[model samples]
Target chain A: MSASYSTHSQEKTQSSVFRTSVCKEALVMDDELVLRQAFASDPRKGCELLFRRYYTNLCNHAIRFVYSKEVAEDIVAELFANFWYSRVFDDISTSYRAYLYRAVRNRAYNYLAWQFKRTDSMDAIEDMPVDPTLKPDEVLQYSELHQKIEHAIQQLPAQCQRAFLLKRIEGKKYTEIAEEMQIGTKAVEALVSRALTRLRAELKNDWFLGLSGLVILSIL
Target chain B: MTPLPKDILFDFFDGKATPLQRKLIEDWLMIPANEELYYQYLDEWETRHMQFFPPLDEALTQYRQELNGERTRRVRALYDPPESPFRFQRWFWWSIAASIILLATGGGLIYQDQWRYSTYRTGFSETATHRLPDGSTVTLNANSVLQVPRFGFGEGRRLVRLTGEAVFKVAHLPDHQRFVVDMGRGVQIEVLGTEFVAYARNRGQHVFLHKGSIKLDLPQGKQLYMKPGNLFTVDADGHGKLTETAPAQSYLAWQDHWFYFDNTSLSEVVQQIDEVFGVQVVISESGLARRRIAGNFKATKADQLLQSLSELLNVKITRTNDHIELRTLTL
Candidate 1:
């Protein structure tokens, strides 16, 4: 980073954390470097700094899997708490962003799997992994795709967006979604179907998931 | 099938891929282009995730507390401090004495800031009226505080920070400088020049424009162009609704110590009494509390209002300690 970057992050945390780095320039170091240094010296400060850096992004990523804010928060909180409790500093082979993002994604999937296990057979999602590979380029691509999908969803009508979210993200059935949204079952289905068709069309050029993948994705 | 079709990536994500398909997909992900495509498929499946936005501030606050809690427990365990109640008592009194000295010195330093804004407060049954340097008049209600800029009144932005309730009759500047009221809690009222009755307390902030138009700056970056009879109410949760036509004069009745309630619930009237008199009032009867009362009364004391309400509603008002209780009158 540039010379101004350290002063910038310092300004961000100035009101909260007391600057402890005797050398002023060291405080402006890269996030991963600071995390490693802090973890080697003081684990608590390292954890807090890491939380500040990635908490929002991780929560946003978790919210993608489990629609509820409170549930997503619980997943992220557990991920962080587990990281500290298990002392995963020695295991951080990749970048901190990759490690944290993968952690949040795994925990979110576990939550979804548990939700599905309650209603259906656990065998449907038996091979869910806890530590998926999160390469830097893959993370960037997914983030961009996430933004594009978010924009497409935003283009939907207000009620349609609500109904579609209730069905897909919250995993509500047609009848349950109808009752919650005060719409008929047919209307709920139509809205969700419209959202799916619109999303497929919007992502057609960018999607590498050819015709068959799109069909399968829409089905299950 | 060497590179594995992209369909296998979806099957892999869904946990339905066969062993051979999974191996092919894993091998494909080793290449950067295939990995990007794989992540794009994953993002497509999560399109609904953008609907709800979870604020990270509250989560981080909770996390900070947990971190501090763990650190405190670890420190206590490592130190094994002595459990001496007497020693704690001695240190507590010494700390109290030190705090008193610090506060005495701090008060003097605060009074020396003549250039900064100063707060004007009113106690119970006491109202304050002040004229600003820009010829604007402010009438602060009882148990309220208004902080106005001391030195820079007419220069830049004519700004005043308010809490509780106040009525402002702002003066119009030749230069057309805007006057703004920053009612903490993310609520701000801005105007070029206008007269308005504003109430901002525990419940929420309400603005009733008396005359002239003003632009209200809402918390969430929404601006409201309010007319003369507009009544804008924003609750603590930032949920706002504006009533286009309002009894704007009735809102300013408190300036003269006269309250006018037209079909307003007794519970709401009692809340106003609590705010005006700064007292604890308990209504025992639920029906009586919900009863819509319409009348006008002039009273500055809680006892006077209670006496008027007792005759008007045919209820018995009794004082028990500092609390006033209202119950149905027995025949």
Candidate 2:
């Protein structure tokens, strides 16, 4: 594995070097260096630069999960507001880009859990042993949870799947979906509810296991 | 463990990482500084495949407002402590009592107008006839609201606000008071003992006089007088037109659940249905929307109208809840 990894790394370094020289525009200075220096000298200017750079990217990332443009923008705005109010930049050890993406992902997950009324899952998330020193484990858990939820969505009935996607992925109102499908709003609501019930049933065991793991970790 | 290459991180982001590669990346991510490199690569990948670009100016403006609001709140918290440890208990109780009284009076003053007016509403597929205090009668169409003042309705002025369609029969007073119907958007009807049908909606403003004379106060300081049987229409763009030979009585046919269409386009017919029944009509083809039909149809419900329309036009109409779809018949 180590031998393969080294060969892969060597090949990638040569290709990246070639690609950067050919396709990429010449950047005068590294963004991180400028941002860090600005932050050390003047915090407000640093915040402005950070927001101008990452606000759109963060919103785009958030909308992939939340599906509503307004909600995505709200989440990014709130994250920035909290970042400023809590003085997180002063103590953050990771690059701002890394911290912002992870924070936005966590926040988007929390929002989805709350929106779906998954109280048990939400409790499991809150109780997840958030040892910042072992952040890789939490990242793995998030990826697994996201994959499970997506898989369960794909397994829904055709009609139920359409209704769920319209409501969640397209950010459409029930009345709008009813109008499009030529069905009543009540039918749309029923379809969405049926989808949620199936999703909850599929996720129940995973959440239980996660909660138990948290319990054991707490004991240890 | 050795650091993973950028290409492997990119592969992981694209969901193309094998278990062995994933294991190596996981081990590499265990280092604190490598996590930053992971995010930097992720950011680069995201930039290459960005799905949306949010409105920057609007978001920045909102963020500035949030920052200012937070600063003000923090300043307030620092300067104004709700209760000081050195303050007397009696003064605290007195201040609380004083604030309650002040809040009550202040709230009452702000909401006093809500108590002065009474609003009447009709739900979807429903119509209602209301008799006002001055012996005037109003028949409201479906999905409409009318607001009339509770007090002083007939004393100094008889004024009412209308949102949707309604037929008004103003009662003549011996003192010669004018009746005014405010249709919003600076359009109003002034009458003295008259019968008229007024249609006010987001689409247009239309007034058809049936009995006696009435004056229309339109937008842009324009006034027009209407004789009986005259139909005055102001479109969504505030362009006004008058038809002297209009069949004014046909406008009141809705009171009898009858619709009179004289070579009316399907689109206009659908708009009328939307106003009167709150049902949305979706025409599958633009050519179908321009088809004209001339007839008197009796339909108390939206489905009945849709059925009759489908038969008359030789088209297919399907209804579900509050939505109706019209399509050309396919053989």
Candidate 3:
């Protein structure tokens, strides 16, 4: 374990570590160092650092499932509250960021299940397993793209947003959604269509780092 | 390579394509280049609709307020030593003696009658019972405390706040009056009429229903129902588990000045000792914390429990002025 840890530390250049910290230029260090400092002294600062970094991203991820801002905020806030009060923050096994994201996602699903009154069995949200082969920079870029995509969706017309969320998140069929929303089937289709067109136009010109033409072409 | 039409691909992505057009797009996506284009559009499709944007600043402020409230409540709970004047020592005799003297001097009576709400406390190696106005009864374990409101006894909700371990025998009321035990940390156990043991004091609470049933309202708006012989454990970390087990009557053995450890870890035993006897027991070796011991023993005194544990684990128990240290017996 010590050998692997040493190699891991060696892999992170001092410059990158310094670049990561915007405040505290002289004593800028890695997450592990920050964690150790937290374990030793006043842990609130370290906890706040982690909370600030991932709070927005986690809220965005959670809103995808629960679809309510207040509920999502309550979920994340309660998670951090428990994390602090229960001392799990001191004993995180995996990378702290991954742990926080997974926690938020699981709770969001649970909240959605409770809200939908499905107490017996929770329907699984089919999400693609994160591609482990992607580099750290690629992961960051993908996360940024994900947030940007969510923001763009939020900017769409209200009807388009509702249609897209019900179909995509709730996994509702267009016919079923049309019936529920009291609209015709073609309106649902056009709403989804308009939503897609707007999204495509919004992302078409935005330059994403390391997103080659071939990659975009292959995926489209 | 032939370029696939964008309109057909979009329909296929949304699962709205006709059978014939679906086949066409499927075939086109079979090509790696077309597949890549499919994912790009798929990403865009998934990204385009956002339902809500939480105000991060407001959420942060709320979180900070919750944290500060918790800290303040904890401090208030610990320091509000009502009848016990010399509570700083927290040692077995000095604190209990202080309480006894206060009780004799009518300090305990004054404290109880002063506030509309009543608080019940037990010193180390002591257990006390308080009967509520609704005919329900609560028995607190050693070093535990419970507060019952004087104003709203049997009116609507029979609510009691607990800071340590307690066993409750709730009276069944007509009209289905709610009997709720607020266990703090956003956890509440509501029972109409039941016999259950609630253990708080640690970061979380463990509730075992010996008879009847109870409903637990968790922090994240999830409700859990527990039946007889069910053990529900929830921690401050937002983790919860429900297990069906044998009647946990042994869990309340502490009420009788005894402890029953069934394959429990030494660390937990140490914590129980600290709670029940007001003595901090520190094991020098970290590995010894995991040593499991099962036994039924008396817990009237701190040294007696430590002595039994020393013989059981073959460790040397040393008691200082404030803390007890357990060390491996040196050969």
The number of the candidate with the highest DockQ is 2
Q: Score each candidate by Cα lDDT.
A: 0.63, 0.69, 0.62
lDDT of 2 by residue, B206-262 (tens): 999999999888778889999999999889998889999698557898888889999
Instruction: Return the TM-score for candidate 3, rounded to 2 decimals.
Output: 0.41
TM-scores for all candidates?
0.42, 0.44, 0.41
Query: What DockQ results for candidate 2?
Result: 0.13
In terms of lDDT, model 2 sits at 0.69
TM-score of chain A of each: 0.51, 0.67, 0.44
C-alpha DockQ of every model: 0.06, 0.13, 0.07
lDDT of 1 by residue, B200-256 (tens): 998788999988888878767878888988999988776788998998657888888
RMSD of 3: 20.8
Question: A1-220 in candidate 3: lDDT tens per residue?
Answer: 2455455433433323223332332222344555535443555665676677667766666666444454566567767776677666555533455456656655654443232221111122222222323332332333345455667789999999999777655545567778989999779878876775676566555465223321111101
Among all candidates shown, the one with the greatest lDDT: 2
Error of 3 at A22 (Å): 63
Clashing pairs in 2: none
Candidate 3 residue-wise lDDT, B117-179, digit = tens: 456778887888877656788999988877665322443456678889999999997657778
